[model samples]
Target chain A: MLNRPASDTQITHARRLWLYAVAVLVMAFLILPTFVVIPMSFSDSRFLRFPPQGFSLRWYESYLTSPEWMQATWVSLKVAVLTTLLATPLGIAASYGLHVSRVPFSRVLTIALISPLIIPIIILGVGIFYLYVRLGVVNTIPGLVMAHTILAIPFVVVTVSSGLQQYDSNQELAARNLGASRWTAFRTITLPQIRGSIVAGGLFAFITSFDEVVIALFISGGQNTTLTRRMFTGLRDEIDPTIAAISSLLIVLSVIMLLILVLSNRQK
Target chain B: MSKLSVRSQPIAIRDVTKTYGSFNALENVTLDIAAGEFLTLLGPSGSGKTTLLMVLAGFTRATSGHVLVGSQDMTRVPPHKRDFGMVFQNYALFPHMNVFGNVAYPLRLRRVSRSEIDTRVARALDLVQLSHLAERPIDALSGGQRQRIALARAIVFEPRVLLMDEPLSALDKNLREQMQIEIRNLHENLGITTVYVTHDQREALTMSDQVVVIDAGRISQKGAPREIYERPANAFVADFIGESTLLPVQAGADGFAFGGRALRATVAPPGGLFLVARPEKMELHRTDMDPAYNLFEGTLHQLVYQGETVLAQVALPEGQTISMRLTSRREVMAALPEPGKPITLALHPEDTVIVPERGQ
Candidate 1:
């Protein structure tokens, strides 16, 4: 390409510019909805449509004042926290077992652990809804947390396992030979080395549970409705401009949390 | 140095063997390491030196036989319970800890008080001369500094036994040599019973009071460095320990004849013998003046110049080669022997070691 004459340089530059412009257009196509919703949310119009004549913060104030929204937000946050606590340990155990087992069927075990991610979320939600109802735990915080943990565990395993791969096994053996018990060696040496992976996995798990909607739709009764479930209700039944406002707020919150997670990982 | 408080354990491995499936990682290897002695398990790669060290450290269990640390049977003991200090090949410094924290780790595990921990860690750092860098994070230090920290950490607890598995292998050549001397000095000062493992023959000879040469999952020979180098038991030891030129000789009752000349030697000459001649012991001359010695006429095949010595590879009259060393290339020029010209190579009677041929 560099061998081309100066006369053809203009043609080559034009071609590259055309390609970049096309890429920009494609990115705008994908991000257009997210950008359109922010302004539509602030519109004073009652309908959930763009190009409003007036702008106001009435919907934001309504969302802030409503007990239902506040309760659902609190429920989502609690479920995310609980799901992270459960899934991170369980995923670390599963990944460790897979890595250190040296068993013939260890690959099969790993695949089984990650199978939830392979399945469609709707199918899992339907099955879990029936299971929760039979177990008499539907619409309860524990039931929601359990379902979310099941969904979040695979991400945790992948992240933590990748982190463990960077660690040196000899360091642990060195600790053990230096008079540390196996558990103590793991606690002091192995855990600190992979702390970043655990944090990253926990962040993924928390984000997974916070935004989960299909399972919440089935299991969350009015008393235990999560923020996602309420947004779904507003979308389906009312098509309220409030739903757009909630979605815009959720997008902002997710961006902030994800930014923090990414920045923390970079620091590590 | 003060006497070590912990009683030195006599490490004994009796008929110990470890097998990973069909591969015999270690066979019925047995030896006793005296307390407070610097013993090295020396061998090339896959020769079971590291495996034996692991067995002694209790990181690995023998498939059969018992490992005794003094009177206590250590076969079933776990690694942590063995309380052995180990320096690994990579130096294994905790990346999360500073130099002080790293040295303090063993004491922390022992539940020593905070003030005692501080004092002991300071002393250990001082032992390696890294006291000023105690607060610096381990990753910030150079390779040699980190290794010194590893050594300090290993001996901070004053454990009864220290195990080092090629701990200096990762450093540059000059740095490795320097560390070898430093570690030897530390061992002499502390008198901690130590087992060091390395494949580098020079390292084994330099640091070990007694060297155990291993091959094919067994101990081939064991003795002091001078003894092992001077009188290697077999062809393996002679070749492995240093550069040796083995010449085929037809033996008579009094002496061995090579290239139609009866060579003078002190060692008994069997019917057929292999003479192990070290390069430095062989002399080269243009004239056959040393006819009384074991002199063989040869052509100069090659000349190699090391910084301190010049090695001359001579092609003998019997279609064989012998290497002789000189202090300078000027010596070779003084002899006035061309590369293709013929000359005589002579070995002193005491320099030629004779061994009977087996499994010929």
Candidate 2:
């Protein structure tokens, strides 16, 4: 009898240990490539390698000093920031409207807004490229911004809608009954409560626009080439280590944006 | 903060009806709330009391009706323009704001001066006795404190009419009782026309100057608290207001007859009727008690001890039962008989009310 209870406890402990081991392995597998890129960026050789024979900062210097790389980086930054500004408010408005509309077909509208995420990115890229070429707006900054905005809007809508779901709309009604106008109630009461979600949605929009390459490759070129498009060409045309350096920088930028999103969420 | 002049306006609801598809939430309801009067709408769940309150607040539109605030037609007006203060069921305080900020929101909407907002908010908090916690975050306060904050916010602007929808329903028994007294006192001091909604019958009887009983989208009865409790209009009101035994009776040549025995009543119904017997107004007797009282011989079935009083269930002839409440005094407890023992009970004829049988 003693042996039976002892073996049962031992079995439970062993099962837990095995479960933790599998979880650690899964996590490591997911994050291993991200960590591998950091060391490869600092490799002295022109080609990507692991366990580098030597270390140097030539790739970083090349990415920083080259005018073509600098222009691409600037273009990407501008588009991401503008996309964030344009999409956050629009998404918040759409979410609030859908929540209060009580229309019979609101579910259909929500599915339509989220369709961009489900549709193949290449098909969307080709379709938009054709439209932009016909309008003579190809290779323009405005065209790039418009394409990126469309891709980022779904993320904003989804995040803002979930945030609004946790909100008590009765607070808005209470404000209105106390003599505040409808717009004033929304601005003062509802907006501040959901500020964290709005900030998180804007960050997601920025990241989506920044990382977008498929649409950028199809529509953007010459003076307004996005960083991702340039990186794609650099990989295809030349075996430049500068791409690794840019990848490392992009990874760091994403971590910083995610950290801001987490901190804003904690504040709420 | 000094006392400021605040005008009160009477509300007139005329033939209000609200329907959703084929179901009616409210049907042809008309009520007039006098200026500075405290009125309560009492009903069970889904009885349309809350719908009536929402209509007055302009949150829910009526299918066909006219709502007038004083001399103005407020039927088509939006809620924000109606300028009525409302306390929600959940207290609905903004979680992002402090006590002072929440209480000062309505004042800020009117573009009041900054210094004036501070003074008025402080005074409102003082009225609710939470002046010391004016700077506290909303999450830090207890449920009762949040309710008080909601009350202070609703009254800070001193709107013409104040509406409350089950504001104390979330509180525990003791706190709810305490808040009811505090709210009634506040209403007396402010003298603002107020409309309150609650399903608790005791709360309605305690806090209302006028109690309106609503049932199934219609007004069952409307009167003072005493009139509603002592003289309920029908079987529904009597069964709803308090514990009572409603016995079917028939009109005899001399008086009313229940189970072929003559029973005296203060009021006579035209056709079928029910004799409403309040538990507390009943007395238990052994020998001849009084000739003026209506007497019924029965067997004692059970005695339910309820702290200070005992509920005695008496089984009469023909399988009918009536409950009598006796105080837990020494003499009363000693005189109580065992279960299945024969006993006689006396009920005053004046305490027996004859209300018409429903649907006839």
Candidate 3:
């Protein structure tokens, strides 16, 4: 008991000090640009600057008071929430049905459900634009939500499928043998065990819809323009500090989502 | 207690056969269990013992057959509708629930009163002698304790038929033996018509009133523990149920002959092509070979001493070898001849078993 065997796992805390240095470099390379935008949002100059000439909240005031910017932010918020509500249940049902069903081509059905994730965003945007024109829903909030839901569903399906695969289905059968009906067994025994993964998937769906730009550019315009699409247009016309302020806020939202995901994984 | 109101039921499986593609998992299997009888379907893995138990529990539908529960046809009944209690091999206790919640799950589904659910859960936990740990999380329990909680959860509703699928296979030897006696005692108190599935011959012998040996998708032998161990119907059952070297024999209308001599066994359903010589049932004959006993001429090959007994391996004339066990309690252990010396081994007439030889 006194001598612990040396295992294959890398005990990086005591050994391999260089690994931590490399990890810090990689994190800075990936994330340092996002933090660079935070100080630029407070610049008093007319244009965005990484090292601000003077510190002020004029850009934040412009984003909050302008009618066009406020309307775009509200549209983005409504579409993201609606997309999350619609996509999560559909993705869960698809994943669970594929797991339990003995029907032929279930593998093919799974591939079809996740096909939106692999397709090029430009091509998918063009396809959705054509479909929305025929359906007469272009430039509307409902059209934006429907387009974003399609993009968000793959995240939910991938997360929930991993959770289901880790679960032992015999627990459901045990519940059924103990006198619970099939639906009752799933509700009481199966769902509660996989709750952490379900919440994670819902968070992923929310972030996916909130950050979408290509599909919104194709389908949304005028009063239904989303925040991301409005920011894209603002950058195209001129370099504005208002877009930097909005990007800093989006970065904070993403950080909160990552924190929630980490906490959910700890529960599992 | 109020838990004594369980109505035990008999089960009947008539001509059940289950096949996957071209392979038969169970073929023409028919068994009838009496009320409150503990029957074990014993076989090696993939030998259809588990499939038969699943059919009885309504989890696997038979290809063509009828299953009757207390004179009611339940061949098409779903598992949820059957009301048969089952304990899985992994002890599938709900991880999110505490011990009390796991035990009270069935009662909650049945719409039992909340107060009654609490009392019944307490009683079930008491049955397993784990009443003090009712609020403990399931992940905190050890393997043996988890097994007991699974048992408590399965029987809390007092379903008429209780089925267990090798629930003790995960346990160590000492704990397994302890749970065996505990389960048998629980069966005696509940008096439920039980069907247990286990590949362990000793476990089946220790726990059940009826032992059914299945081989390659068919019933090979069915009898009491002593009956199957002493007089296996075929070479497969004989070799599977105990430690034995089955010597080929000649059986005819005249009688059974082994090694150029006749064999008369006074055990169950006799007459086959293989003579079963159990090592423990054989004796190291030191004096002149008696004609009344079935005798063999061989040289002492070796001796194996293991704690309480020493095994003597003797090589016969035709390159065949046989073994006999001498207990440490006997003085004959000191009298066993050295290796390569001419020795004689003997078997009483009642101790010899002859069984038909079947293909693997």
Candidate 4:
């Protein structure tokens, strides 16, 4: 039967069915955990359990009303926003500089910039923690923002660099030939063409800073405790179900960000 | 339509040379472009024609030379400060902007009023006959339409000098021919000093008032299209400009000798020589008809029947094949001998040019 020739209709049907099966399996593996967590967040049990005896908003109420969870959420938000603002422009400048300058060590510079992504998160966390202690910036908002920006910048550089790659440098030359200054050419021609990549990079930076926990656990403490660190502590020490509520909310935020990226990519 | 004011300026390139590490992209080139003249830099790929045009546009800096516009030295001037308009090979239209927005960009950069920008952009579009699609997105336009948009955008600012680098190479042959006329007409109306670069010899011949033949980082010759075609300076220029068979010639005190016979020539060469015979200038003769014509007997090796013309390849005694193009008249085709038949073709002494071969 495998050696027999098949009609076009049968072949298409079989191929599509195989692809559908693989897609369904992949989606389940990706999304099933988030779906389970959402239901467990609404459970009326004292401990984490699926298919609870009843459903209630008790964990969500605890998460909203408790000062510790609220403070952690505020810290995460502040650090992520600050990191996006600082990293996006710096990343764009660095990518454009590397692209146009044709520097001798550009490949080495790119590897250096993206090294954080390749290095182990534990090693990066330990290194940053040591550096933070020396600088006397541990547990501070600026310190946390600085660490998040460092992680976020690589994403910006990578995304913007790919965007710049797709952009034709001749557009900038055309603008300059038409009597526009170099800065104006970049602003009016090059930037607008790659605006989608800039937006995607900024969103990725926000998500990276928001979801980061390894570096936060090492250097963040006291009043500047991040939400992920708080959630870790809650799971390890207290076994609170409010951690489930925060996890569900974080999942929803990440899903929304990913949806925006998909829509922007489709627009391009 | 109100005629836009475009001041034409003469360009002077003085011994410009550009070297990239060890490779020389342009080597010690000097030329002068007259005001309101359309000059074309024609050469094969990697022949430095585009590099010379880039130096003129101020996009590429010459290693050591001077560039002057009218009387002002602009060797160090940046591209933007030079205020020239350029059409790139790929059109380079902004995908984010509509057609009008792309064309109006330069005027806006010059701080022209919004109303003036709209008027000028519309007029430019009208000149290119693209006024109907002013608001269309660039992605929606065809390749020919995109080229027109690029042309409109480049000239919309009324720049004193206009540079085009193989602008029509992306279009099909028919469109390219039509746009060549349109650009020539536009140049006549606008009178901007234009420098065009292309590898297409026919395009250079059709559109340029003066054509500069470039070869391997240097200029071989610079003259009018007819002059370059009729009287090439050397074997390289002769072979480059048109289809020609350059036969090696022996130079002596009397004249040049080719194919073991004394051939008549207008000018004598010093050392190594070549007889440049353009295919179109050759005619098949029953015998030596004119005393002023030099004759050659060869075998009819191949006959190609084009619709309007027949290309016949004749193998000379020295194992060199010379192609001759004849109008496909009934009598001409009938009188032509078959393949492997002996044929006699004649070349006028005036049409045959003896040029000194370069590098011996």
Candidate 5:
């Protein structure tokens, strides 16, 4: 009974019938088109259409077998995973330090760390492209990973910072009081409690890097090109049916990440 | 569980002061806690009691002071090295850990053998009478159960010093009272030197071998519960520890006089400005009362019939009202005079207490 949400029970379902209608309409308006690609990707038609000519595995087979598409997928995965690894720890450290820091301007430092999310991505893309050129790292794996990490960090920092906020830091103090060192207290007490937030933050970083196109367009090219960049180039050059299959796959990946985030939170 | 034992050590806090800019959270406070003694720092909120506890726990650094545990000066020691066990106000049990895990945390930190950890953890859980719930999640327990679990965890490591900051405040009144006796008993068995902090005077009285009453940033008074209650050092302690009326008195060549009437007491004046009268000690005077009892004439103002006791409020000639407490027995209620009637109240010399106007 306590876990039940305190919803507007005063308004009966019949009385608020229009609200459900409007909610369905709003969700359908925003989400309905993204789902259309699923069925179209299965179509054996020459052109992408809502009503497919007939269902077949040709486009999916094309995506799975094509070496370029497979390479782009591999690149996206590598970059996303690497970005998750690099950004999670840095973001968690910044947030933890900021949480316990009595030093001045920690708030300003947090804002600076999370500024990438607030800054216009196109502008950041141009700026990174210029910096990468000067550093002689454009079109390289390191350049792609570095750029993607920069874009992914803000999401990690924001999520993990929020996680740190909800956690009661006194547990760490209690651990210290019970003979655990400061670092041990954090690892044994503080870390396990906020594991959900850290995982969620990592997921956010992974998704941000995986779907990022603006920065990849500017600095990523050749062998290091991300799947998003490849998809963009393919769409620009003649819309391939394989793009539909890949879009369906991207949508599934995003859904899986969202599910993971929701499931982790539920465990907490 | 019965075999669980704790080592005891005396704590000496000398001239400890904690200052944040111009505000003094603790002001030159010094206290010595005897080995295995249950001492309570009792005060109102923001009275620096918890701050003093923190200083002892090494969580808060004193601006200048020395904390000697046994003979070692541990003033510069960090909390982790201090080896003190503390139960936080909210218990601070790891949400990710089960009951056994929560209680086993401190032992695990010391890298106790896995088999020994299981035995000791189970014993601690048995001590708290929650061994059956060893695998239960923290949030699954009730408030009172969590309080017991917190106690079990704090004492499981057998630290020489155990600090508790309002651990029972979250429990309901009945549970709080039950836990108070339970903790006092546990302290007797374990013999760990304990320092507890609470704003509740009754809890302090029921649990502590010594009580330090803090107000503002200083110790107002420290004594045994009966001594503090029976002979409060000043008006503050007199009023804070129990129900009392502080009737302003001026010191004269003879003795302290309350509004030109001499107040007689078996206990001498504490060299203060108020004659503290406890309502429960004052009775409705009968014609055959002791001749040496102090007498006051007043008009009955109101009679409050509480479930357990009856309070008869009286308005003195000078307009200072003092209540007289009476048991709510059938005969006692029948013998009471109605409001607006004149009455005489008596106080035995031993029941009278005089204190200074301010705690100073």
Candidate 6:
């Protein structure tokens, strides 16, 4: 006969096994969709039907050769680059001012500065649509770029602020004590410490603006359509297998960018 | 300015007061530091030691005071304009820069020639004995090594004065003691008037030419180390500066008395008093036979062997206990007193400092 306590231990072990099974199931739940899209992108078919009869790189080739897709891709790259350039320095300056200000309502000021992040993107899209229209920026590349930068600035602020938190304020003072001007202290001592955060923030802003579709939909139309907008249009007009191909390529690009970020940070 | 015996010395702060809202961080403080004096602002936490240092360094502004270096008023000067060197509590070495670059930074900002900057950086590194590791990244250095690097960087510019805020407080006991002597030696060699801040009384006493004791944002006492330790102005200074076993005593026209035993005192009675005694000053005997002045009959309550010294807790008949430190090895070698053994302890009247029992 099995000992009574031994049986109880077996039951407890079985319950733990069940719990582990559930946890693994939940983990799979989150990762399933991302993996599923990869194989579906390789399908040699007219539609995005999974478990394809064969696999081919025909759709990838199709995207590569298409002038419209190429143009949209270039536009997205240009916008992401412009947004990063415009957002990073502005965000850093704004954060520096907010950090150093001896104002009574500093907390209120920070909240107000970062309110763009809290407001719904849909509302931002609507507001930008009307404003851009009034400013005669509709369907213009510069207008779309400016709109994307506004969306990206908050991420830059938050990330750069985190970097500034680890910085030694006294180090700047030490610089000043050595006969450097205030600006010189800031440039020599203050800037180098938080450069990582600033770069990281720039990368984030780039990606946000690049992959953005909502504001692009509102402000950009016709010839100025972004790659994301093009992809959305492609999906709506037809169940294009090219969407899967384009998405797969975008995912690879994102992974590569993420690797660069991780590698640079690690090297630091 | 002359290299030695300049017309004006290092620094002078006159009636400096710093306030945060209604709380005074430092109040009406004045001090003059000689060109080569190694002065320490020593106090416990919240004692405005750091505040005063910051004010002098130009990182902090005083609400109502004037700070002068040489003949120039520096009260309105910003830190960078004042041209002082400083070491922070956490070392604060630039993590991104290698050791050589960190030491060379201030020189670069001053627009020194590149070759001179390199020469000075190497010399600074040599001064800290870190020349071999000049190219190593800051994160590669150990805590003690990083601390030395910070010191090297601060001095690379050859500032007229150096300020340090608890630079060794983060180090372990052994490293802190070692760095203390190293820093003291550095100060003597360079003859750069330095202001050091710390709360460790032992560090202050060991390292400084003069020690200023602060409490609650005010200077409670300031003197040479021996003077501050031996003649603290009030009960706070006396108790805070060193370990003291204070006993409740009555000082009347006759003499001082505690626990029904009359004791000798140096000064005539001003009022009721609390006598402060250093444990090391009290002598102990095994048997209760003492005709010496300021002697009391007691029982041995506890014995603690503390490496270099043995601590004895003696109990009077009234159940009051006082600790006595005995440094004699022969005393411990003999039969140690068991708990409750009758004993006698003697204290010199001169060593018994009488303080008023106000705010006890």
lDDT of 5 by residue, B77-190 (tens): 999888888889999888889999899989988889999999999898888889999999998999988888988899888888989999998888899999999999889988
Which of the predicted structures, 2 or 5, would earn the higher TM-score when compared with the native?
Answer: 2
TM-score for candidate 4, please give it.
0.95
> Taking the tens digit of each residue's C-alpha lDDT, what string does model 2 give over B1-360?
465445788989999999989999999999998989999999999999999999998989999999998999999999988878899999999999999999999999988999989888888888899999999999999999999999999999888899999999999999999999999998988888999999999999999999999998988889999989988778888889899988888887888888787887776666647888788988986566668788878899999999999999999895789989999998998998998898888888877787875421
| Candidate whose lDDT is highest | 4
Query: Model 1 off-target regions past 4 Å?
Result: A1-23, A64-71, A127-138, B1-7, B248-273, B285-297, B329-333, B355-360
In the order shown, the candidates' DockQ scores are 0.75, 0.81, 0.79, 0.84, 0.75, 0.54
Per-residue CA lDDT of candidate 4, range B222-276, in tens? Answer: 9999998998888888888789988989876778898778998765566647888
Question: Which digits, one per residue and each the tens of the lDDT, describe model 3 over residues B142-255?
Answer: 999999999999899989799999999999999999999999999998899889999999999999899999998999988989888987888999999888988888775667
Question: Better model by TM-score, 5 or 6?
Answer: 5
lDDT (10s digit) by residue, model 6, range A1-268 = 2233465436555446778899999999987877677787888988988776489988889999999999899888988999999999888997887777779887887787688789998899999899888999988889988888888888888988888887778676666776678898788779877888888889888999999998988877777789999998888999978888888888888888888788867866
Q: Residue by residue across B156-275, what tens digits does model 6's lDDT show?
A: 888778899999989999999999999998887788888999999999999999998888888887889987876566667778978786677876557778877777766433654667
Give me the TM-scores for chain A across all models, comma-separated: 0.91, 0.94, 0.91, 0.92, 0.94, 0.89
In order of appearance, the predictions have TM-scores of: 0.89, 0.93, 0.93, 0.95, 0.91, 0.82
**All candidates in order of lDDT, best leading:** 4, 2, 3, 5, 1, 6
Q: Evaluated with TM-score, which candidate comes out highest?
A: 4
The per-candidate TM-score of the B chain, in the order shown, comes to 0.90, 0.95, 0.96, 0.96, 0.97, 0.88
For model 3, name the residue pairs that clash: none
Recovered native contacts in candidate 5, as a fraction? 0.95
> Model 4 over residues A23-113: C-alpha lDDT tens digits?
9999999889878888899889999987754889999999999999999999999999999999999999999999998789999999998
Interface root-mean-square deviation, each candidate? 0.8, 0.8, 0.7, 0.9, 0.9, 1.7
Clashing pairs in 5: B272-B356
Task: For residue B266, give model 1's deviation from the true position in Å.
Answer: 5.8
Candidate 5 lDDT over A1-268, as tens digits, reads: 4334358555566666788999999999999899889989999887777778898989999999999999999999999999899989988898899999888999899889989989999999999999999999998878888888888788878888888899999899888998888999999888887889899999999999999999999988898888999999998987678889999999998999999989989987
Q: If you assessed candidate 2 against the hidden native complex, which CAPRI class would it receive?
A: high
* Candidate 6 ranges beyond 4 A from true positions: A1-75, A94-119, A134-136, A162-182, A234-249, B1-8, B248-273, B284-300, B316-320, B331-344, B356-360
DockQ winner, 3 or 5 = 3
Error of 1 at B87 (Å): 0.9
**Which one wins by DockQ: 2 or 3?**
2
